[model samples]
Target: MEQKQPDVVDIFAVEERPGAVVFALAVCLGALVLLAQMDEQTKWLKGAALLVQPRFWPGLCLAGFAFFALCHFISTWTRHRKSRQYSFLPPDELANWARPTEYALYFMAYVFLVPQLGYLPTTLLALPALVFRLGYRSPSKLMASMLVGLCTVVVFKTLLQVRIPGGRWYEFLPDGLRNLLILYF
Candidate 1:
């Protein structure tokens, strides 16, 4: 009787991500170039002490990460070129990612809206919508989400003095409560 050989699967970089790796590398290079070209005499940089300039740490860290990503990209490209593997997940797989991609867009929109609507109002609006989207349709759950939003507002804004993006929305609160919010937040 002959012994059977096990099958092996190999993943190649170019086959794996197609254009995504190149796009990421280009974005990284562009960001590094932008950072390099930034004026050093900006007000924030001018005001900061040496070694503590506003851009120093972030620039250094981002440059380091970008360098590492560049190295990885080159290594992957070379390895993939030499590889015999042909099958890989394709960019067309994005069609299968509609729900998650939409959720990510929703999250980004939420971030943008927070400052405009203010924290409490944003949270109060977003939490219920998120819960509903996540398939929790109970009235009690929505109400609980609303209650949690109020509690979060009270704890962060009233008690802990966190300056959660305030807008003209706070003006609608009754005077005593509004005064407290003005004092703490």
Candidate 2:
């Protein structure tokens, strides 16, 4: 007679990805730093109930955040300790994280231009230009982007009656057409 053992697998284990450890460490450190600054950032008023104090909830939340982040960092570190080494700051992952910042700056530029160039003209120019910048070389795609931008302006301004100011350049146009465009284009 022979006895056999069944194979067992750890269901809770996760595959580590590149840069995960660094991200976890960063989050944990950030939480700890914020938690340390809680006293300076918030006040504890005398005679105020603990529940209603301005600092109470924030302190509690930051404490919990720090605790959980520390736990995650410990777990990640332990999991990866025996595995193959990875770069502390992988360039590809850092670049991926920063990529959204470019789009955010673009949005800020668009916001600034809306006041200078009017809503319709800005939308018309921005949409196609953004499409082109995103590498849509086809004429049909560019036209579609312009159409979408135009429809959005019409819907928000004309149909919904949103309050957006006329562009600086609008005053240069003939008075009647300028007024018309300013009011509902």
Candidate 3:
């Protein structure tokens, strides 16, 4: 003789995926911020039709966004609380999200160096150095990065005629070469 087994029942079983709650919270906060700024960022024109008013459509969209985001956040919060999958915030997921900030700072440094070092020199140096930093030791890969950098400089400075200031160091070069580098390189 065998006893009967009871079935498990879960009404609020949310799919346990990493970063879902964090993403929902971020979206909710962002939408709320944008909705709060709607009055300042948009204009209310006098005697304008509702359909054509500058602020009307933007306000409607922002309100809808905020409402949906709040609903999503509440739903996720309730479901996660019931399931007990996470406590407070997920530090590992947040750290992974912030990992790209280093590259952004690197890019900012490159932008700062361009005026001091000139476009051609900065691009050439930075690309290879970045490749090396990423642990590529092969000569071919380094040379390829350098070539790509040179082509970028030529396209922007020479072909497209975009205005990038010459390096401060160009003042030490001879007149003809300095002029050539400033104008085309």
Candidate 4:
């Protein structure tokens, strides 16, 4: 006797998902709204209290988009069920959930390190580890990651003159090495 196949819900597919994607989108929009509101809520009492005036326009735009998307998705969710726009993603059971979990852990580590180690070092370190975790054993991957980091430093630090944190970790290095790092970073 043959076993019956389990029914799979492809959340991206119109006929299959039963409107769950709409709910998910709504939730995402809700999150954006909350974040944007928080950004506006924390404006400096003395006007741009940080070293520079951080941009607030992007947050404003996100808030506006979230409001409209919430309205549109809620209203049209049912109507769109008849649509043929199927999502390409496989069912949750077939999806590799472990990857996201691993990445989330990496993200948490990145957050903890950013303040102590800063952006340049954090990014340079994260790239090689991420590439290794993703199972790319080739030396080229490591080289490429380093090259990308170098390009990022040149473009953002040298060309654009963007202010990236030098991080405290670099200070622990010997004088010559630290000076070399500071020159590039």
Candidate 5:
């Protein structure tokens, strides 16, 4: 009896993820470059109180992301080279996929709606939609998930006093709504 070797296809399948990795690296690099330029514009302020200088933390974070992304890109490239297979997608998968597109659209919608709809409504809607899409079938589970999400938002926004994205819809709601929300939660 002979042991079967792992298929070349299986090893190279990992390479397909490099495209996503490269895209992330490019985005991080772009953010770092932007932060560096902004830092240069505020060079005069650096001479002020060292603790008060606004750019220090953000610039450091951006630099850190860039460094990490660079390492990831290099490691992924080496893996791709060793695997010796260049495939953009899985062998049987279609190029024009709608699932990813749908998720992106949902994310954008959530961002845009957050400021107007308030935290609770937007999250309540998005949570159930995501849960259902992820193949969760039980109504009880969906309700429980939504409740947890709503509570998290309430804790962050109300108890923690964290700034939540407020939208036009929030503005139209009566003062009673705010009072009601605060009292109920």
Candidate 6:
């Protein structure tokens, strides 16, 4: 007899009680600890006094996350009384997920190489690599994407006066490049 295959919904369902309980417990505990730290930093101010405090927003965010995580834990506990084995991702879909790693690595390479290659070269190289890695086979899409990315970077560096890594190469680029960098950055 052939074994029954689990449906996509079943495979991804959070029906494993132990996993849900553990995940929720971890998040709640972490949030509580974070809230305590925030309270310490904010000195537990109340009412109008709390409104003026700098730590108020961070503390509120932590408390909110803790509340939601706890609610999810409780709801999961009630709904899935019995633990069910489930696959997090089916084998068939794994290959598609794996392709993005190449793009991520290329991005990291650009980050590390930016100071050495200067912003323009690093960005120019990273953009094409990323576009190709994402399975864009058409040369037109790749060129258009690269041009758009580069133009956006140049505009920010030049027109907006945003600072980007330029290294020693900044002084040597043509006046047009410098003007573009100054205007965009």
* Index of the highest-TM-score prediction: 2
Error of 6 at 62 (Å): 4.8
Model 5, range 1-185, lDDT digits (tens) per residue?
Answer: 99878788876564345255445456667866776687465554735876677766776777787788777767766776667555434333334444488889888998887776667777888889888988999999899889987898878876886766555565566898865554333
Tell me the tens digit of each residue's lDDT in model 3 across 27-128: 999999998898899998888898899999889999999999999988887788888877557788788889989889989999999889888999999999
For model 3, what is the error of residue 119's alpha carbon versus the real structure, in angstroms, after optimal superposition?
A: 0.6
Residue 49 Cα positional deviation in candidate 1, in Å, after optimal superposition = 20
lDDT of 4 by residue, 64-159 (tens): 767777766665654555564554343553355445876898889987886577667777888888888889889999889877876887888767
**Candidate 5 global TM-score:** 0.49
**Model 3 residue 117 CA deviation in Å:** 1.1
Error of 3 at 90 (Å): 2.3
lDDT of each: 0.69, 0.90, 0.88, 0.67, 0.69, 0.68
Off by over 4 Å in 3: 1-17, 45-52, 74-88
lDDT per residue for candidate 2 within 1-185, as digits (tens), equals 67655545545546887788899999999998999899899999999899999999999999899999999998888877867566667789888899999889989999999989999999999999999999999999999999999999999998998999989899999989999989997
What lDDT does model 1 reach? 0.69
Between prediction 5 and prediction 6, the one with superior lDDT is 5
Q: RMSD in angstroms, candidate 5?
A: 7.9
lDDT, model 6, position 176: 94
Please provide, for model 1 over 88-152, each residue's C-alpha lDDT reduced to its tens digit, 9 standing for 90 to 100. 33445445545488789888987888767767778889989998988999999999999997898
List the lowest-lDDT window of 10 residues for candidate 2.
4-13
**What would you estimate as the lDDT of candidate 5?**
0.69
Best by lDDT: 2
**Clash total of candidate 1:** 0
List candidate 6 segments past 4 Å from native: 1-23, 33-65, 82-106, 171-185
Per residue, candidate 6 scores C-alpha lDDT tens digits across 1-185 of 99888688876675453345555666778877887677467655456586677777877788789899889877765555553442333354456557678767877887888777667667777787777877897999889878976897767765566766564566677989866543443
Clash pairs detected, candidate 4: 12-87, 13-87
